[model samples]
Target: MQGFEWHVPADQLHWKRLQKALPSLRDIGVDRMWIPPGCKGMDASGIGYDVYDLWDLGEFHQKGSRATRWGPKEHLSEMMQTAQDVGIGICWDTILNHKAGADRTETFQATKVNPEDRNAAISPPENISGWVRFDFSGRKGKYSSMKYHHQHFNGVDWNETRKETAIYKIAGARKDWAKDVSDEHGNYDYLMFANLDHTNPEVRADIFKWSEWIGTELPISGMRIDAAKHYSAAFQRDFVNHLRRTTFVGNHDTQPGQSLETIIIPFFKPIAYGLILLRSQGQPCVFYGDLYGLRGGPASLSRPACSGKLPILMQARKLYAYGEQRDYFDKRHCIGFVRYGTVHYSWGLACVISNTVATYKRMYVGVKHMGEEWTDILDWCIETVIIDHRGYGIFPVAAKSISVWVNDKAKGRKSLARPFDTDIYDL
Candidate 1:
């Protein structure tokens, strides 16, 4: 799943269309399946993250995700199994920072509007995404899920302001000025984006229970934690520990009870395992945002699936690095020298390079791959020798022409504008 991971409302998947394309996915280098966080109201099995009813895996969708019915409860695990059948791993995103959207009667939401229970309810800092925050205290106020990352700039609602900031503007932030305020609490603020009342011991307990169940119940291989930055470090640590401890297959079965696993691999990065000390423990992780990687002119935009090119480039820093010793090798030619070996080199390098190309072409001025991306490359790594290209012409390729470069002179000067796909294997 190296290419842009397709995102859509869950219920919407045209299973037939996808079923037909199953082979194609494997054909590409996509063996990893990722389901984003908070699928509520989408074609998911139920109300996404905001409102959860874990029991009903059947017909779990609310609205607008998809018309085609896909069992909700087991959807995730099923997908994981499906992916595994096809040599893929299904990775789920957990928005542990919050619950689904607030219910009018939910204590956290009610307290925001009523204020009487503000002291007893749970809501704090502000919502992690600042899209929805409930007044757990039954009071009124604007909130962010966490405080470590600054979201306010001089009361101008920095969240809104940052949208116009250089990179933000490039990412399509439309508002020049936006105002947000919370008053007369009691689920008064709507910015938190479904804040989880972790402050509530009950809330924490419930989440732990469900997460534990999933860990032991689902057949999935891993989790992608969402809004992890918003949560307390201790809580995050404990939650992951709990997940790792749960057992998905022990006895939690349909016959009597079943389980997915006590723990699936939780590779963390900015969102999930930020609190975990990767140095001390071999914590798996993923990094976000390589906005500048697309600067490579048409290469990034027009890249074909499983192009060994990108994969080669990604593995370069570690594979090449010459004499440079570093700890990690990453995108942006970002390389880490290794006085000592690290899991980074042993494990696969996964980077998130978004497919926002409309603006990319304009910014790079035709010269891409020059901008700053997540770097591990301490040196300019050498490139792989082109081996083959698939998705070729309406006509068949000459078997003898297999190893010719994309710019091969022998192809009668007929270079492909779309380089098509190229297979990749460990070098």
Candidate 2:
């Protein structure tokens, strides 16, 4: 689940809030959380997008505060440790496209480019002053001693001297817009603020060093690159490769024996969520807004919590939905499949999904044990299905919904109980 929303309360002590809710989140089958950016932004209330200092991370007294919008360094560390103790992994939101709130302004030769087409230079190359120098005096070169200058970046949108707002492409030798970026606006490499020139070796080395430092400092399982399209793809690949080789970071083969399969379906409704989670494909993820309602947005724009539907589906995924599969995709609107459980997890299930009218499908669940009684674990369909001697059962699903039918006497049926029920796991 995403640990925070766009408008989560600025002073909510969100790190501690998530740490407190870790156990409950784990209980609902949330193994990892894609948390907001942990690095210090432009200010205390900055939501990490105004990337000021990556190395600070609420540690140094920079950006008008010692802590980011979420919390201080100590709280973030505590939260990460808590998540680790509770067997939940953290996916840090990494911002690498640009830097904001520079320590000082520096004079550099830059050419004003057309906003619609950055390749078309509108003005001649002239000396323009912009906030392009970052000494990070607060950090005092603790984690990384390398400071940033205009040569380290490709462009800036603002010229401090002229007080103008236009796409000013920083002009220097080997300082053109990166070619390995999106071709929009002629060249989309220059995004916002001091856009880091991935082509610069110093910039690449400093970012790689910060990536390693953050990975080792925090107990993070992975990173979600922010504004990835605005940077060099080659640099991103090399950064990941460097992390894999230098430290236990990145989403590659860092874990010894575990293969991570994540399928993040953002802003999916309950039915869509059911179709994905109750299947035999990739590991499905639950949206935080769906699982625990959204807050702080406009009242009409806010969404109430999904009415106790996701926990059941998540529980089903965790306890059952295993083994060999059989697919019945004869109809366009209706489809079904069966998982013939393995020896270790032998409480196989049959799933029927329909996007239109209510329907049923006859699917085989293996003829090994043919006389088992099956019922919808979702409790959406009250009817019970009986497997015939051929191991085929007619499973019923409601209109525009799904039904996950499992053996009525499945060994772990008790553990598939709904969340917040008093007698959950007592079935």
Indicate which candidate wins on lDDT. 2
lDDT tens string, model 2, 82-126?
999999999898999999988899999999999889899999999
TM-score of 2: 0.88
Clashes of 2: 0
Question: Which regions of candidate 2 deviate over 4 angstroms?
Answer: 249-268, 298-305, 420-427
Predicted candidate 2: what Cα RMSD to the true structure? 6.2
Global CA lDDT of candidate 1, please? 0.30
TM per candidate comes to 0.40, 0.88
Best TM-score among the predictions, by candidate number: 2
Q: Worst lDDT window (10 residues) for model 1?
A: 358-367
Per-residue lDDT of model 1, residues 1-427, tens digit only: 3211222223334233233333445443344544444234323443244433332233333333322232333344455565667875656556555343222221111111213322232322332112232222211111212211112110111122123211110011221112122232322222233334343455566677767655555555677664454445566777778776774211111111123322222121111221121222332222111101221233442223122232222223223212312232342322111222234432211112212111100011011112212222111212222221331111111111111111122221232222322321111
Question: How far off is residue 149 in model 2, in Å?
Answer: 2.0
**What shift in Å separates residue 140 of candidate 1 from its native position after superposition?**
32
